[model samples]
Target: MARFTHSNKHTYTGTLLLLSCLALIGAALIADFMLASSSYSPAYLSIASKWAREKSGFIVVPNLNASKVGQKESMAVKDKAERIPERSLSATFADLPAPELEWEQMPSAPVPRLDGAAIQIKNLFYVFAGYGTLDYVHSHVDVYNFSDNKWVDRFDMPKEMAHSHLGVVSDGRYIYVVSGQYGPQCRGPTARTFVLDTKMRKWRSMPPLPAPRYSPATQLWRGRLHVMGGSKENRHTPGLEHWSIAVKDGKALEKEWRTEISIPRGGPHRACIVIKDRLFVIGGQEGDFMAKPGSPIFKCSRRHEVVYADVYMLDEEMKWKTLPPMPKPNSHIECAWVIVNNSIIITGGTTEKHPVTKRMILVGEVFQFHLDSLTWSVIGKLPYRVKTTLTGFWDGWLYFTSGQRDRGPDNPQPRKVIGEMWRTKLHL
Candidate 1:
């Protein structure tokens, strides 16, 4: 029996040794398989390199050589400023008639006021959320039918006297109203952000801005909405920062406004246009306005009325460059801007101050800056002493309206805001 037990023990030891050797061999095979699988795949290298990674549910890959593309530092200047033909201010007076355009009057809005905003969508004109004397700025949203020269009252602004100077942007389905003033007094600012769902025909709260502010300029970039150049104190600031907001899966996300390389000291009232992914800040008050004896409220040349004659470009590199200057000085130009035929055309805005009130002048003149040429030339203007601010389009016709008309001291028309619509066409 002792002899049998010794033999059995030897057999069991040999079996155990065999099993351990087999297990090691299997493990070594698996290790080699994993190493080969990872090494042979170039796609897995994409996961390893973080530089080209973009994962916001969009899963877009950044161009790996984008940084290597040396910047085109300098551009040959092509555009030049020409003489201001006297025909611009009095085009309809048979002075400077554009060969393609025949100027005439259009029906007016129901109410007479300035500072109102009008937006065009799918061939319909939606004018709303502006402020003027009817006690305080208006809350009533008016819709004008250019086809029939009729008016319809839609939804009133959620709040009152929110003389909102901000523009609206939409994806053809949802219209987003950005930041502006809420209280009758500009002292009280509003950070409210509202979105109107055209499909639902209802208002929904997306997100409120970080602070109550007005004149928040917004544009869409790389599928994200970017807003820049606004006020914290209702005047010029070294603090006019740039911010970006994004919408994903129908939910909105915002980043804090970051000071982006200090944009030139352009006023919030400046005319800004985004052409070819570049932000052009043109035609605005240059100096910051603070309420005081020599502030912008005072209209002093160095203090309040520093007109922006040069065009500043914020290119894709996010750098600022001074472009060609306008022929004449321009400021407080009411809606002195209009975008037509892929070119930014600017018309009547006050180039001079009022002799008596010392306020910004109400000049009826026009200019066109061809984006490709980066040059300027005087265009067409209205015949009468036209005032402006709210400028937009309707019924295939360019319409201008809602500006402050200059009234003499005895005019008592201090609040005599005018709301007239002048319709014209953009000659190619």
Candidate 2:
């Protein structure tokens, strides 16, 4: 094994050098094994699993980031998965020096902004684009170097990306961003793509999305970046067109936009992730509940709210199937996910009446999904129930910040916009 010093204070554990080499082996072996056994491919997965054992940590969790996201049970006739052990994972949110959230006075963003965002990388937090009240995507990028307990402005996103369909993922090198919205109010057609080099402070353009969609939760699977559901033309008619682009040489491509198997016409803004070789999508706005076994995407549209406990998964053959469903119907939260102890650990998102609601509401909550049995249940709740704009997990503890809550229709109601703050761990 070879070791090299990374500028970031956190130690890399000497495994990153061979990460790509091992990933290539895993991909190749898995592909071959799939060819031999159409339906079953264990031996190929074994090779990939072996390579993953050594290098997955470097690629998956390179540093500490703040973000956060689940499912239910089923035991029907043949080929049904068994009951998963209902787990209540006690979270471990580390306490920060300063306390921000309050019930009386409105908490303010470290910087006055909403929709502007943050990301954690190499043991630090980076805040970027969010729209101002006048509706302009800020070009300045503010980074919270948690290690040094200070804020630093590194580099702005490729261009102005405000109210855009934001999706970001990192491979410990480049911070790949997909965000673009056009028009006067930013509620227009947007098609833009950019890649930021965290080290060199550079940005590059790539192929844009086939359509101008926003607010879709993105999932990275097997070296390819997948953009999940988000609404485009008609907010009510959410697009199930799943778009993906291959990334190579520190660049994310916009071309080769393949709209594979559409989701169950279950609407958009659902929490999406690929776990254990299966893609799991949770919750969305305005979709049917009573979907028959082999029904099309838009099966039931009578329901008012598209949100539901419905959790869908795509098998190896790319067939969409529903899972046990969630504890309740939830949509439009800062739903990011991280795996802990073989369970999906989901953290803070706005589960209230509105994402920008300023009034006090208990939307800050956490839950888990046990892959083995695949059941859903609440684990713990955030100490302060606030609808944060964004969430991500890194290093161990979960971090969330930078979103507005309803201030209510009143006189001089101040909306709280957090620049960057971490969880106060109510009861981890």
Candidate 3:
């Protein structure tokens, strides 16, 4: 009986040793497979390297040589500003006739206001969400039909987003309203983002912006919504941060906010437009308005602020190239800017304070920049001096409406506001 019990114990000890050896062999095989895969596969090496970098707090700079190939292929961008024509920065209006344009008067808008954004999509012009008389902020949406040539009150905005100064961009179907100011009294900024579907005429909330801002030069580029240059609280606090949101199938993707390098100062009220693969940032105000003797409320500056005459172009490589400054600095306000007939047309903006009166004067000047020639020329002037006019371009017509007229001492509003809608066939 003793001998049989001893035999059973030996058998149990042998089985335990075999199981332990098998476990170690399995672990060894797994370790070998992992090491082999990582050493042989580029993808595995990349993922492991990324993980290591994240854990080690080390950043690996991309190889510039490898990136250039992808950049040239993906963007198909043109060369730098060296390609532009070398000519006099200022164009002369000596022989240029009044631009070949046909003027037409449209029906009055239900709400006569300024500081509102006008965007045209498929022949329909949507205009509203600006301050009215007596400092009244509007939430109503007013749409104008080109075929019918009439204005219709469509619907109210989801919230009070008046005087935002921020503009809207479209992806052929959805119109995105970016962050803007909500305070009607102080003209403060807010970080509210929304989108409106023209088909349904409904506004839906999207992710809010990283910071509150107003008057941002926003646009759609390369399937992303690029929000650049504005102000945080007032025009003084220039928004230096650049953010982009990737939208897929009319919806902003989750966790898609990308922060790029900061732009130059004086970003507010700047005219930003994407031509081909380059983004052109034109005149803007460097400083903001401050209180002065006799003028207690908000009003235009008195020749104290710096108006940017410098034209900055952002290339496909994300580098900014300085172009020849405009002959006349037309910053501090939004100029009538449009790209047409391979030319850039800007007109009717307030210039620096009049040399004599020390008061900023409304301008009636019109200028054109030829893309092919890379030259600028004076294209005569508008029929009337105008500034801060809500403007848009569709097909071949440039639409402008309801700008503030110069106010005299008797006027109650700081500036006299208008409500007229005018359209003209712009010869590019």
Each prediction's RMSD to truth: 25.5, 23.9, 25.0
Each prediction's whole-model lDDT (CA): 0.54, 0.52, 0.62
State the lDDT at 207 in candidate 3.
79
Worst 10 residues of 3 by lDDT: 86-95
Candidate 3: TM-score?
Answer: 0.68
Residue-level lDDT of model 2, residues 1-428, one tens digit each, is 55456674255544553677798989866764543333222432332233223211211121112111001222243433322111111121111122333222222335645544455677666666665553354666667654554555555554445343356666667766664343223344356766777788888877877876655656666667777666664334466678778787677544567676777854554566666788788765653223323544323222334344467888788788877755444555534455566777665443312212222232444667778878754666544544434554545555566655434322112255545455432222
Which candidate gets the maximum TM-score versus the true structure? 3
- Name the TM-score of candidate 1: 0.64
Q: At residue 37, what lDDT does model 1 achieve? A: 43
lDDT of 3: 0.62
Writing each residue's lDDT as its tens digit, candidate 3 over 259-351 gives 976777645676777788787777776655433435444543432555556677777788778765554556534435767787777765665
Model 3: how far is 193 from its true place, Å? Answer: 1.0
Q: What shift in Å separates residue 145 of candidate 2 from its native position after superposition?
A: 2.7
**Cα shift from native, residue 44, model 3 (Å):** 66
Show model 3 residue runs off by greater than 4 Å: 1-102, 160-162, 290-304, 332-335, 407-414
